[model samples]
Target: MEKTWNNKAWFMVLPVLLLVAFSAVIPLMTVVNYSVQDTFGNNQFFWAGTEWFTEMLTSERFHSALGRNLFFSFIILLIEIPLGIVIALNMPRKGWGVPVCLVLMALPLLIPWNVVGTIWQVFGRVDIGLLGHTLERLGINYNYVQNPMHAWFTVIIMDVWHWTSLVVLLCYAGLVSIPDAFYQAAKIDGASRWAVFRYIQLPKMNRVLLIAVLLRFMDSFMIYTEPFVVTGGGPGNSTTFLSIDLVKMAVGQFDLGPAAAMSLIYFLIILLMSWVFYTVMTNYDAER
Candidate 1:
């Protein structure tokens, strides 16, 4: 006997599709429309084709911002991935310590992004802020508002403080999911701690590590709020990543055409890079 399929399930999905169209698709189409046109006010728009895209591609400002984004993401991945793994490895696998450690790890992640930015912004101030005041008393010339290097340091540190917990949590979940049988087998084989980690634990955590890397990479690359609140893209545009630059163009300068084009390029770059990361990591997993 042949079975009949119910078509009503698609009806249940229709509302979600409509919501996505209204929220994401329509705005994207508007950006596309703005990207290929020029306006001189009074709703007058002229066809400019790829003029904005070409200009953005050739701009030194764009290159600088892109470089900053790449460098920041690289630093975040380098620091957070290994740091998170180490923390996860050392965390208690059982007992009362587990909940305490988990809760502490989750506290930072619970803070709102804007609030985190605000907290760091004040925390790095030279006069009243504890960190800045202590550094000053210690005769370390630290001021995020004036020194580009200090601003970069503050942003990087703030980001690590705020987001590293996510990596820790992911790694911990991966670690906890590993069966005790694997540990037992490793122990029977007289595996050292390093050997167990290298041969057993690391392999098991491969998928979560990939997730952590991709999430951290994308977040760091598109970072805006925390750094913006902390540095305002200055002490000399030193911390001006792509998202900040795009906002400066769109909202600060009101160059809608160029902003729209840059945004599209920004979107594509992120999409391509994420795809590359996923492909590389998945292939490695498959090989292993």
Candidate 2:
């Protein structure tokens, strides 16, 4: 028997496809155009080939920013993944406590990005802020404004406070989705808590864990507003990441050509890394 496939469903999705092309594709093409060209004024552009790209590739400033971005992402993943898992495991899995815990976890995620930055910016001030004042009273020499290490610490803690909730929620959802029968079987086998988590929970959470990792990695890599508000990439470029550097080039210095080129490179790096992450995780899941 010959089976006829219904192709009409594509028509329903055509509107969404057009919306994406308009919002995403057109802007990307514009960036690609600027990346290869130079313009001074009067809506004029001159082709400079790949000169901007080559310059960015050779620039030490770009290298430093890229290094900062990679390091921050690595630190975030290291801190968040296991911490999220632990918090999720400890959270109440049943009764009214479940909803209360979930709401609290979600509160941080509800705040706007800029708002989070602003909150941390003032909160870390030494004189008037509770955290800074408490630290000072405790004889701690903490000053994010002048000290690079303190700046890094403040930014990291702020991010953890804001985004760890997301990871916790993801892991918690994964944990709760497992059937009670799994726990019953583990109990029948007289499995220890560690063994149950190591085998049943971890394997069950693998798919959501992959999603959480990818999401966190990409967001951390492209982080901008919060750090910008808090540090302004200050204290001598100590905390400047790729997104901040790109903004400095494009808007701060008006170096649109190099900025556009850098933006394209940044986009490619993210695309490539995300593909690599997806491929590796899916392969590992398949093997397991």
Candidate 3:
């Protein structure tokens, strides 16, 4: 007997589709309209073809912001992935310690993005902040407002603190899902601790690791709130990544045409990079 296909499920999903179109699709179309056209006061718009796109692509500001975004994202992935894996591996697999470890790992991820930025902003002030005051006492010239390198360092560290927990949680979930039978077999075979982790835990965690890496990369690339609050893209734009620069162009300078074009380009870049990451990792999973 042939099975009948289900058509009713799509009706269940129709509301969600309409919601997405309303929320995402409509706004995106508005941005596209702005991107290809020029606007003046009084709601007047004129066709500018690709002028804004061309100008954005050729601008030195765009290049600098893009480079900063790439660099910050790369560094975040590098530090967070390994650090998370190590923390996950060390976490207790059972007993009372498990809940404690899990809660600790989750605390950073629970904070709102803007609140995290606010907390850090206050926490890093030279006179009032614990971290900055301690550094000052140690005779370290650690001023995020005055020094570009210090500003970058503080922002990177803040991000690592806030988001590394996500990677840890993902990896921990992957680790915990491994059956006890596998560990029993490894034990029976007299596998070393290193060998067990290398062959068993690492392989099991690969899928989650890929997910963690991609999430961190995308979030870090588009980071705005925390960095904005902490550094305000200060010290001559040293820590101003693409998101910050885009906001400055759009809101601060009121250059809607260029800003819209830049935003679309930024969105495309993120989409393309994420697709590449997903494809490569998925292919690797398939191969293995």
Candidate 4:
């Protein structure tokens, strides 16, 4: 007997498709329209045909912002991934301490991004803020508002504080999902802690690690709110990543055409890099 499929399920999906079209697709099409055209006001638009794209591609400002974005993402991954794994590894597998640790780990993640930035922004000030006051008393010249390096440091630290919790949670979930039998067997084999981590835990957590890496990388690359709130892309544009730069162009400078083109390029770069990350990690997982 042949089975008949119900076509009604697509009707259920139609609302979602409509929502996506209204929210994402329409705005994207508008950006595309603006990207290839020039406007001098009064709704008058003329065909420019890739002029904005070419200008953005060859612009030094674009290169600098892209470099900062890449470097920031790299630093975030380097610090967060290993730090999260180590924290997860040390967390209690069972006990009253488990919930406490988990809640504490989650607290930072629960804070809104902009609030986190604001908190750090004030906290890093050299006058009334506890951290800044303490540093000043300790004879350290720390001021995020004035020094470029300090601004970068503050941004990096704020990001790590806010987002590392996410990585920790992901790693913790992966750790908790492993069967006790694996640990028991490793123990019976007299495996050292490093051996257990290397031969068992790391392999078990591969998928989650991949997830953590990708999420952290993308978030760091596209970081805007926190850094913007904290530094306002100041200290000589030292912390101006791509997202911040795009916003400066679109909103601050009102260069809509260039901004639209840059945004498309930004989207493609993220898509391509994410694909590369997924492919490489999945292939490695397969090989192992």
Candidate 5:
């Protein structure tokens, strides 16, 4: 017998669809409009075609910012993924330690993004901050406000401290889901700790690791607030990643056309890279 599908569910989804269109599609269309047109005062817009796109693609400023963004994301993923896994592995799987570890891990994540930035900003001051004062006493010349390298280091370390907890939670969930029989069998087989981790725990964690990697990558790539607050994209332009530069253009300089074009291009790069990551991981999962 043929079954009749329930079409009434679509009505429930129609409101959500409209909401998304209004929230996302409308704003995106506005950006697309600005990207292909030029406007001065009085709300008059002139068609500029692809001129902005070409300029954005060739500009050294754009290139440098893009490079910084890619480098930051790479470093974030490299540091956070492994660190999270290790922390998760060491966390207690049972007893009171479970709740304690979870609460501690969650504390950082609960803080506001701007607050995290502010905390790090004040926490790294040479005069009053513990880190800077200790480093100064140790004879290290660390001034993030004046030194480019120090600014980068401070931003990276701050980000790691703030976001690594997310990875730990994801990895911990994956670890806890593994059946006890797997560990019992490994023990019966006289498997070494390394063997158990390599063959069993690692494989079980792969799915969560992929999620962790993707989330961290996107956040790092799109990061604006924390680094901006800490470094102000400064000690020159050393910390000015794409998002920061784009904001400088759109809001600071009020260059609407080029900024809009750059925004679209920036968005496309993110989309393309995310697609590549998803595809490669999916294929690897299939192969395994």
Candidate 6:
């Protein structure tokens, strides 16, 4: 028997296609146009052809921001992945506690990124903020506004608090989807907790772990609002990652061509790195 294809489904997707074209494709083309052209105000354009791209690639400031972005992403993955796995392992797999735990995990994820930043900004002020006041009262020096290290630390902790829950939820879902029979077999085999986790649980969670890492990496790489709100890209440029630098170039200085070039490079780097991560992880998983 031959199957009939429903061509009407294309009509249903037409609106979504148009939306994407307007929202994403059009804006991307605008950036590409800006990147390769020079404008001396009044809607005038001159073909510059790779001048901005070459400058961006060789610029020390751009390199520094890119390094900071890479370092931040690495730290985030290192901390969140292990911490999430531990939390997922300890969570009640099936009980009244399950919904409670899930709700709590989801709460931080629900908060707006800017609100999280504002909350931290207020919470870390030495004069009036609870955290700052307590640290000062304890005779410990803690000031995010003037201290670069403090700003970086506060940002990292805030990110962990806000985003770790996503990893936990993803890992927990992977854990729960696992068959009870697998656990039964392990128990019967007298498998140690460590062995069971290493040989079975970790392997089972691999796919979801991949998803969580990619999501977190992309989000962290493109991070702007929280750090911008909290640190304002500083304790004097120390916390300025690629996103912040891009904003400063584009809006702060209105250097359209350089900023546009930087944005394209920024996007390509994320795409390349994410592809590398996916390939390495999937291949490693397959080997196992």
Candidate 1: regions farther than 4 A off: 1-14, 281-288
Better of 1 and 3 by lDDT: 3
* Model 4: residue 195 alpha-carbon error in angstroms: 1.0
Per-prediction TM-score: 0.93, 0.91, 0.91, 0.93, 0.92, 0.90
Return model 6's CA RMSD, one decimal.
3.1
RMSD in angstroms between candidate 2 and the native structure over all alpha carbons:
3.0
Task: Score each candidate by Cα lDDT.
Answer: 0.92, 0.94, 0.94, 0.92, 0.94, 0.94
Better of 1 and 5 by TM-score: 1
lDDT of 3 at 208: 91
List, residue by residue over 1-288, the lDDT tens digit for candidate 2.
998799988999999999999999999998999999997888889998999999999999999999999999999889999999999999998999999999999999999999999999999999888888889999999999889999999899998999999889999999999999999999999999999999999998888889999999999999999999999987789999999999999999988899999999999999999899989887987898
Better structure of 3 and 6 per lDDT: 6
Q: Tens-digit lDDT track for model 6 on 1-288?
A: 998888988999999999999999999999999999998989999999999999999999999999998899999999999999999999998889999999999999999999999999999899989998999999989999899889989999999999999999999999998899999999999999999999889988988998999999999999999999999999888999999999999999999999999999999998898899889887987888
lDDT of 5 by residue, 106-177 (tens): 999999989999999999999999999889999999899999999999999999999999999999999999
Measured on C-alpha atoms, candidate 3 has an lDDT of: 0.94
Candidate 3: where is the Cα deviation over 4 Å? 1-17, 187-190
lDDT of 1: 0.92
Error of 3 at 164 (Å): 0.9
* Superposition TM-score, candidate 4 onto the true structure: 0.93
Q: Could you tell me the TM-score of candidate 1? A: 0.93
| Model 3 agreement with the true structure over 1-288: per-residue lDDT tens digits | 998897887899899999999999999999999999999999999999999999999999999999999999999889999999999999999999999998998999999999999998888899999999999999999999989989988999999999999999999999999999999999999999999999999999989998898889889999999999999998898999899999999999999999999999999999999899989997997898
- TM-score-wise, the better of 2 and 5 is 5
Off by over 4 Å in 4: 1-14, 281-288
